[model samples]
Target: MKRIYLLLTTFSLLLLQACNSFFDQMPDDQLTLDLVFQSKQYSEEFLAHAYSYVRDEADRKGGVPFDPLSDDFDVPYSESPAYPLNIGNWNAASGNYNFWQDYYRGIRQATYFILHIDENRELQGMAGGPQLIKQYKAEARFLRAFFYFNLLRQYGPVILIGDEIIESDLDGNDPKMNLPRTPYDACVDYIVSELDLAATDLPLHFTAQSERDYGRATKIACMAVKSRLLLYAASPQFNGNTEYVDVVNPDGTPLFNTQYNATKWERAAKAAKDLIDLDILGLYKVAGDDGNIDPYRSYRDIFLTPWNNEVLFARKSSDLGWPYEKHTAPRPIGGWPSYSITQQLVDAYETASGKRIDEPGTDYVENGFSQADGTYTEAGTYMMYVNREPRFYVTVLYNGSYYPSRVNGDQRMEFFRTGSSGRDGARDYPHTGYIVGKNISPNSDVRNSQFISRPYVLYRYAEVLLSYVEALNESSPGHPDIATYLNAIRERAGLPGVPQSLGQSEMRERIRHERRIELAIENLRWSDTRRWKIADQTDGGEFWGMNTGAGTSLHDPAYYQRTVFERRVFRKEYYLFPIPQSEMDRNSNLVQNPGW
Candidate 1:
């Protein structure tokens, strides 16, 4: 399988490199079908390449502004004037197009392998042949499903190109190629069926010599992916859009598919439950003897440490590879200023006692600390308002908290007030009154920087648990399991469990708050907002910065005092990105999504 994969990969690369004018030219080194799948190892190698394609498209490193543009995160431009206010537009087209191409390329490769793999299986002599073939086919299906999920999220109701599509009379220059969109239901059905098939042959977990394949696709991963996709599909944006109803069948029958179905949500919950029943990968708890061990502390560490029992699937980073640390770390140390935690996000944390600081009579101050001596003053500090959510202090950096100083000889949390002069020779001094991160390391040694090779976490067990809870609550409101699941997350965060007496709406609010605080700045915020239909509430605004001085511009806001930018709203149309104009031109059958 490995040999087949390498040969196909080499062919793909050579084919991709040759210009359109050279399409007729065949590579002399190309392997014929007879030579390609002679062994199972060759087929396995091809599957590995399919997995690699998924990883390459998703992992946005090298300070490359790809991932953020996918609505997972945002790059606040506090400097560039050309694209100053609309930073979201950066990499919007370029990145989406690249992802589209990469995913389709992977799908095409998997289809090719599936088409030919069975023909060469006659060489297999005995015992393990059928099982191995089933497993390989399952892996290919999973890969295909994974690619389709990406397409569905980015471009709704995409043309479902399968091996059959390739063999159809509509292959080249056929007007049917310009056929209208496939029904979204059709797309979901295709995805769900693929996942179902993949799950049949995939192992629950690997052991012994197969331990090296721990991160590969598994039965649980397929189910988890299906659950997540279904949840999104049933959510407000896609499922709630009435205009998308009346989708046509091949026989031209109208399908009223726009209404949100409670059954779909129930199906999602059931899917998640199926994985939990498998009992292989469970939520990771903190280890050690500390009586007050907080499970939330393990959240950041999981990304830093891959193959963590909690990580279901992650994009593996090789030594000396790409990641986000270099861009977000303090410049003098390393890292560009990419994504920063907003004050709104900062205020969402709860007190250790489980009361939100903004609650009535809570004695919380916008700029005052609960403690005296003012060392960790809340005044003008966003971090101060929310004093002690375990997840809060664990994730955010504020005044007086020690950050590993790259510029100074010793680690220090420099508190720079407005008009404060630098005692030491620190450049970019006192820019922002508060440094807004605590998760990233600030080591000065370039070789040891955390930016490179930090594994990109695609899915974690914590998220899976939370998803199960959320779907269950949405489908069956006020279930006791709601509080149980909600409190499990809270307990990990060193807070008391949620009260069972709270109303369903109140409980929902609390769980959402927990999710916001727990998952902040982990690249999940934007999608969460979209799915919840709260993009306007979360993103529309005059996003503020600290007012440092008179010389400061919109690009460089004063980090010392409060400054606001007008109209930083995220419109509803932003929920789904517009399909690239180039793609639309090629496939006339594709319709531009509404408001694109």
Candidate 2:
């Protein structure tokens, strides 16, 4: 096994060299391939490292930032400074390159393993020998599928490179070296097949190796991914478009000869149903006295709990360890103060009855909540409404909600006095006002400075259930089963079930709305918007904040005037991120996506 690890490490080094010329001059002291594949342990470790590449921070940086580029919700001016360029404009030349490179890096490692693992006949002598090789291949395929899915989501029609491409082939000397974009359908087919291959070998759950392999890929994870990819492919954005009929094969013939088949929807439904039948995963239901349930509690807990059967796959990080939480948490009291949940996102939450605050008979002025809609009531004071939906309380932190430290359970309510002095004494403290809620751990013993590693869940059981319901609705429109699925989600969230009187369109709207609130800030919104073709909804806008300083003067305009253009609204061209110009320049065979 050690030999195999050395071989893989050596191969990875070679691949790294291939990535840039810097490593090319290094000595060939690295272990030979012959020495590495001799043992199963070594092979497994190599594959695990390859898996680690999928969730690496470098890969996450590009993808995670791109998430807000969708329509489900918007971030205020406060969060805009994080990535001013990408959020302010649809342009993502540098960001896309980063994403493309990281995905291909993982893909290359996977291809190397698939191409080599079978040749070693010595594997027959090891425990699980050929089966182990097959399993590893399956895992690699799964990772490949995941990367491809991400690429397709961002770039739309991308060049599909299944195997490692030799530099010589793309020396600008070979005609076949330059490949044009694959049709959207072709790319989807490739991803679907890869997931199918992966599902055949991965276990539904990890039972053999406990803690170490807990969050690794599994059969169910592969299925969840496939179901998600196919549903997106079949959506209006790609499948419903007739212009792409021969986009890849402009010669009056289909390049991949793929069609926008309705059967794809059925296939997605079946995949989702298969996962449900596995019975190992299901909705995290929280029942209410009046049968009004709130799914938010279950959803919130899913992120905090490790080895949760609900989480299919996740990127492990400590509690305060995740840089996102560390940076976003209130600084001085916490870490690098960054991304904050905006007032816009907070206001989107509905009351326990699933009604918006502005709805008729909602008692807006009496509740002290100002209606941003601008319709003034007789009451001079804006009511601060409370006790709406259970989820409203579970996920949001309003004016008076407790602001506990993510590390220690220390409450910031007292320390955040209105008259606190500024760090420089010349100006007042910026964050000495309100704090957000939900993501922070309420454990009082743990301080905000403590580093706690909590795994970042990529796919969880709640999503599995939601995906099943979504696929079922799309595949069988108006199917009676829609209510069953929709109600399950609502009931879990302490909300009333959808009335049977609602039409198909209304139900679909409700489902879309539910998904938006249910999955907000978990990093699914960006792709969700792309697949739904709603990028135009994210017009760049200012992030707002309240003025809380040393003075008690509420009339000062500067206190409420701080705003930043953190989000760029969506334009049609923003639907599919432009293919990096660098890649287009190097490969003549590459064609730019439409509207680039």
Candidate 3:
């Protein structure tokens, strides 16, 4: 892969532009790339720069909010970048959340680090010696592979630049600079192989003496990434889909495989099973006084607890401490409360009896108020929110929900027209009459000026388990392990095991529904809906919620009824994000996606 050295003047210009901050500040005598790589400290700094492009999952106000793009939530501000996309204003020219350029810049940084890190001799006499150099190079490899996975999932097939760091003095018209996009399956295989090689050199777990290295790449991180990548490759969007059969390069190279392959599912299942066989991780749990697992605390604390057994990958530092919590807090307690959940997500939660609200014997009531349920709600709580699953109580904040605050003396939230979190000005209310409860710490109080410091999880054991079952069902449906692992997830949530009578089709829908509830607001729903080829059915047309326009009191009938808040457009072309128009203009080898 390193033999093919192809770098264009366009790539050079972008590379120089992206590296100005790292390369320009020093005196001319010390600023050369060779001089920077010769020092051990500077080489470490460059490795850190390679990881600077990882998306902050806790970010809500800055980059694209993925939850709003799916059917799970609505961004109330018209100024949001996702608003144009939701209303059908998206195009190839649309620059909303364009990561194509950012990720390639990261790839170039990591590639340069991998190529030049061996030049530093100071590392040879250090604590870990030349083997430490090998480990550093492997970390760079993992980062490069991670960036390619993000690119492939969003833009489909992309140009794989491999391990070469070419420097050319020729004109910008060189044909080597204009390589065509690699085929999708080939890209998957290359990334998987890179991860496999990286896993060999990375530590399975960092020692307590090296506690500062908690969030760096590890052998398990590599395996976790491979599982997710193969699962996407085996999905309906990329596997045997006739929609992209005509998406070929200018020289007649097919960029997508149109033939269905059941073996891809088998490969995905094996990747997940390989990780599960390690036996080092399990679902994070907390026990009640009676020694039974407390489902509510277990689910709620997964995000708040740092470096727990449940987290396979996490970011140590982020800007989500107070601002993120403040946004989800009720406005009466000094919060913005504009980020709200959708009724579609509210309806997805099963009753405490492990049954859908519409299912028989669910005992679901939607019309009146109820006495305090002793947990999750208080006296006079709305009947619509009563007797729901523990995860629902942990994840959704509704009208009349009890909120605990050290400064506000434990108040109840109100979302009526004249209430605390109701429709006020443009930016202070929830348009859907609900607030996001997941990921916000229970101890955080905006009015008290207190926030919880915690790590943001990137991957966890539960997601890998879910992916394992999903892939196994597709490849070998009714395999006993499918029910065994699926039951593991269900039982942790305090629900009973799934019925063994369910066939493949019934089990498939069941797995998808569980994913929507378990992985909601974790930044996976947008891709999950797209890969399953069901975005048009789930994300199109009118969206409903509690009536935010009416309701002046706590029990207002008008406020309790479901009403349409926004209507969205989801076309077939929206399934694959368009290749940014600027990329096509800059490189002649690049072609626009269909219907962009």
Candidate 4:
């Protein structure tokens, strides 16, 4: 039995050249192209190296990670991307920290792998030679599709470069050299078609009877991508988006269709339903945790358990050391105190019985210190925090909330003015009087250097369930499966089932709200707001935080009040990120995104 890469890829087993400026340029000091594939290790090493291009959601050194980018949270630092983006200071020149070049480089690498893999004499000579080679081809193709989907998700329509290399410059002056942007729908079809071909060669799941190939791409992975891609294409952002009507190719060919396609939603729903039908994945439930479902354990363990059943696709390695906790937790316990939870997101969670506070005939409060339902004991605590959803307790760490940190000698988090981890002690304390609780494991002890590595999930069963519910409601209008899937998530979160009387319009809001709370800090909020065409509404407004501006003292109730920290302004141009000007200068066939 061959040892699989702990990260699901052997890329990290050996360090490779970081730069891919000229992917085709041969290294003068290394193995020759002919000799490289002669050995299985060298060949597998090259293929494994390409896996690093996959996105990392928990990379905080990349500057405040994804959680703070949306209105859900705010970081205290003014130098980070979130701050500049929040204040409307990002421009094409500055904001364009684009991935177009790097992704194309990865695609080129995958193409190279597919083209040269047949030269592997070792693999070709095996008893399973033909089957192994076929799997390799499928892997390369799936990776190529994955790269393209990443580009599509971020930059929208992009040129679909096939598996052939051209002997020409990539600069703007050569019209014959540059590939024009493929139409949005065409790009979607090409990606799906590629996955369809690759899936025939991939397995559903690795059988326990076999000791090899645990983390490789599978039939289910391809289906999930197809579902997510179709979901995006069918969304309001890409489906019949009139904003791109004037945005077309230089030859006057339309890239984004102006007419809405209702069938696309049906296709999305069907695709997601297929993945759900597989039955291998589901909302992760903790067995023997009592009927009162430990929502915290159920939710937190999604990212903690090694290759847990909930994870569909993830980075199965812990490359960084306790970074998630360090970035989100407070200061007294070796935390950065940077990532802070916002009042907006705090208000989104419903009561334990699944009722929104602002809804008619409900007893929930958004403000003031009243101890609404005796969920916990604290003096003059915010009434808004009591009797809220279990997810709210699992997520937000308010001033009075008790949270134990294994890294800090099992010490709990303290967030008031005079508390150990309060604003009075540190200059970089949380901007809002709250911290996020989802990403860190309760057993992780950074203080003792007892580190644990678990897969960082990019796609999970719960997301698929939610996506299916959202699409089903949109397509068939109040479909019953919508309630079935949505209620599954709610029940796991220790909440009652939703009212069956909820119609499509009402269900839509319910679905969105559920996603907002459930998927918070998982890098979905930014895209969700954009795809739902609610960025302008959700993004533009005053951002609130507990008073860091003019609080008199710990005795000041004004210090406990929600104060306006920063006013965020989002523009229409922000709907699509700007293609870096360097790429535009290099490839004239490229057009900048709207208002860039």
Candidate 5:
């Protein structure tokens, strides 16, 4: 635990002002270096520009490709870049979601801010005095380290341009400008150390600051990144990955550590436990008048309720909620309805009693309609949807599901052939019968062009708990703390805990399953599958969905049956993204990912 501070408000204000200020600069009358950094406002605006590079996780269409790239969700249009990406129809030269240049530019901007902000005499005389300078510099460091973490996640080992800034007058042919990628473990170590340094100056929480400062970098956020990054480093994809041994620089310098490191898992477990031991965060819960946990409301409102206890980091100000809801809402209610959830994700939800539907004695009835209302859904709901966990109803928009987004009132959504949201020529519709129901605000009325804005949650306490248990299970199986944390998530979701009798391998599968259900559609599965080296098993080949091609009604046998909607291709090289070929042409020291 470290002392926390608040400085994110300046960032949001800077974002709004950059468009009219820095972005509006012209060559003839552009603000010079001294002119920009001399004034406190301009200096703050420049610092905020570094925050602008944060990923638009809300943009499922392109900004965040992980959601659609995974098996959990589908995008209908072939014209969308993700469509070609899913089918393995593109390459490094195709220029698909190439953020390599964009993120590095962000890193440079942060570095520039850190190097120049002290020139502002006005900032030195501000309310907090010179201590504000240290906080601002730490903030810039967080953003720089954060950008490097993303680059490493997507491109494996990226060129780590440390404190030395590449001078603008430097030639493109200079070896300084065309550096080789750092080794994988070194990259991980550098990122974690940077985050630790940033945390010392950041606040543990933003409660004492203005509400606008809520999303700023905190000690908690730094710890969250450290936890996740170490978990990835410990996983099979990077740890002892023999396939990437040849992924070396031009000088025969290995960019990836080929030897297995068992201690990486121990380091990961310690990082997660460090966060949990703080005891400041808990699973978001809602209790009814009966004083029992209302799992349905608890689960649904985690996204709907802004700034809840479960949230660690979120985007406080964004225009993406409207478009995200518009894409996910029913087509009849002015939505594209193309952001559909796969049947595999639909099947991932457990029964109310915490049993998998395929397991014996789980009592999953595939053919019949519900006889009565269960905990999550209504009477006469399809048997496939009835008796499922509260998270299922909150996450899936099925054929007869009710959507409150209609102008008139709540509408029972239909996805049958004759239904309003169903197939009509080549128009956009869910290839799967279900739409993504997670993170969609219930108050949104897309038909009337109305929506309730909500924060895009980037990290939550549940994930921290799960990460701790996962890493702990890997490092030391049957630890008493494993069941303690794992059951907290399950209990919040209105389910039972795992039996302590289970062995290491059994607990491993259970943890993975819980992650799929708890963190579903949050853009985590793509990396999870890749890091675990299970993407080929889970991401490739025939993807199934309810027959959206046929079906006159909800109960029609032709409509409800599982059908193959798309065939995807996943190769070993797909585990890590290819370094853009343009980058290869410019930097002879760089090596492309294997099989690219």
Candidate 6:
């Protein structure tokens, strides 16, 4: 495990050198087989290359931001992938913003690394020779499995290329070169097995003494991935999905298993429990000097602080004025407004007392607007945004909200029309009339003297807890542990626990809403909806936004209503993203998903 300090600087140079191999018949700049095994530094460099694609969640620079595709947020700009996905303009070739080729290239590199690292003479007789080599091999395997998991989850059943790299001059006539799509369940099994191997060799945790080892594959990361992967395998969207009944291979065999497997729920529950029972991590609680826990600070800082105990896995971004801050921060304080929170997402958070607004016993009421076709009729004041969940205050920023701190002398976020920063204030404006508060760090604004970048949290303890509860409910309807885990999250968010009488069906809804609100803006909503096979119901609706267009001035109350933003179209066939035609064309054995 290499600390990610000045190495990322050299990694950029290595990437450039690797790119030089493309055109030159023989390029010294390339990461050749010889270059990797030269020393521990060089070997670790290659591992770092593989580590770059660990899917840390938010990468605006990567051209594929998944947050905008879901109903939680609306990306009004047409140039982004979000716009096309929202409008249903994407397809196998046309609307495709998928990561197939990049991830496959990573898989190839990882497989090649695993296959050759043992034979490196330099590594054989080094200071930490045997242990280092073993760790390297394990790291590479972890990466290989991780990349494969990413592919399988996105494209459903895909070919398991294994630890063999195709030579540049390989013969096309070889049957082994062109592999058929493996069964979806088989892919899951293979990935889980690889993770199991990885977990055995990896360390349980990284001490501050070895802080540079922070981002590398650890035992907990491997276990966490296994938990998530198994949960997906056990989900209704894949376990027994009738939607993919026709998703078959070129040889006419079903790709996805349509048979419901009850024991899979048990497997998922146990996997999540294994991670939790390790007891090394917890829902972050900010403690006062007097030892009182500040639930709000704890919940908010889980994202703000890097490598906090709550973070199961993360990628720390160099505070080099990263654009994630600039995008989510409003233009009133130098933000790009790339991701605007939706009205529906704002409504999803339970009241501070932990009751749904629509439920009978909640203090929060849905009162802003009334309409027939749309909700923005006779507009009311912004009072409805008040007294919601503690998480809500930390997640969504609206008309009268203030910044976490002063920036360039601005404190209150004046989002009303024609205010210092409003709809017409800058070129970058929130289309939904609400900014994403969750991703914006308190010190990330340009108004501050210095920037603070949080580790891009990929997996966390809260998600693990929710996964356990979900599996428990699916397997045992009224498991006693369900309320304990569910309320643990709620308690950390400054809310009460669940009601004792809550049934399985309502608890299922509770779990989904908890994920939506808890993992808000983490780019998990799209995947969650897909796995639950509820995209048609969850996504295919009229997207709503605060009606900031009804008046040119803040004096008019009509501008404060919930209005239709865009009518989304989610097809049942869209449950599985289409495998690119280019991939299918290249391999005769590769089968397209159920729908293109």
Best by lDDT: 5
lDDT of 6 by residue, 281-324 (tens): 88888985778666667777887777878888766443224555
CA displacement after TM-score superposition, residue 30 of candidate 3 (Å) = 6.5
**What TM-score do all the candidates reach, one by one?**
0.80, 0.80, 0.93, 0.90, 0.94, 0.90
Q: Give the clashing residue pairs of candidate 4, or none.
A: 172-586
- For model 5 the TM-score comes to 0.94
The positional error of residue 147 in candidate 2, measured at the CA in angstroms, is: 1.3
Query: Model 4, residue 298: displacement in angstroms?
Result: 1.4
For model 1, residues 1-596, the per-residue Cα lDDT tens digits are 33333334465553212122211133333455556566565556555666656543222332222233322233444442212323454333444333566677778778876777776554366578877777778888888899898777766677687664243334556765665566777788889999898888898643311544655678777877898788777777666667555444445533336666888778777877777776777555675467665455565455555566676665544222223444334443443433344445555667666777778766454553344433223333343534466566556544344444464333333333322221133333333333445345443343355333344556666676677777778888877877887787677666788787787678777777777776665556656777787876766665543443332221222233555523454555666666667667677556665556
- Name the candidate, 1 or 5, with the larger TM-score value: 5
- Residue 479, model 5, lDDT: 95
| Clashing pairs counted in every model | 22, 50, 0, 1, 5, 3
lDDT of 5 by residue, 1-596 (tens): 01000122123323333233332222212456677667776666666667777776877776677888999999887877789989999899999889898798788878877887788888887888477777778888888999999998898999898887776557789989689889989999999999999889888865544675667788888898899999999999989988888878888989888899889999999998998888888889999789999988898889888988888877665544566888877765677777889999999889888999899898677777887777667777778888888899888999888874535367677777777788865466888888888888767778777677666788888898889898889899999998989998999889999987689999999999999999998989999999999999999999998888887876776788899999999988899899999999988788888888
| Comparison by TM-score, 3 against 5, better one | 5
Q: What's the distance in Å from true for residue 512, model 5? A: 0.5
Candidate 1 segments whose C-alpha is farther than 4 A from its true place: 1-29, 56-73, 77-98, 121-123, 165-172, 206-209, 243-256, 287-290, 318-321, 368-386, 404-410, 413-454, 548-560
**Residue 259, model 4: Cα distance from true site in angstroms:** 0.3
Give a tens-digit lDDT track for model 2, residues 302-389: 6566666676776543223444444334433543332344554555667656776677865322233443432111222124334455
- Ranked by lDDT, the better of candidates 2 and 6 is 6
1-596 per-residue lDDT for model 3 (tens digits) = 12112111112222213223332122222245665577776677667656666766676654654677899988787878888888998788878889998888778878988888888878877888689789889989999999999999888999999987545444466775677789999999999999999989999954321665777889898999999999999999999999998999998888999999999999999999998899888899989898999998899889888888888887666545556777788877787787778999999998888989888777788888886564667667788898788999888889888554565556667888878788855457888888888887767768876777676788988899899999999999989888888888888898888987689999999899988998888888999999999999999899988988788888888899988889999999988889999888867788677778
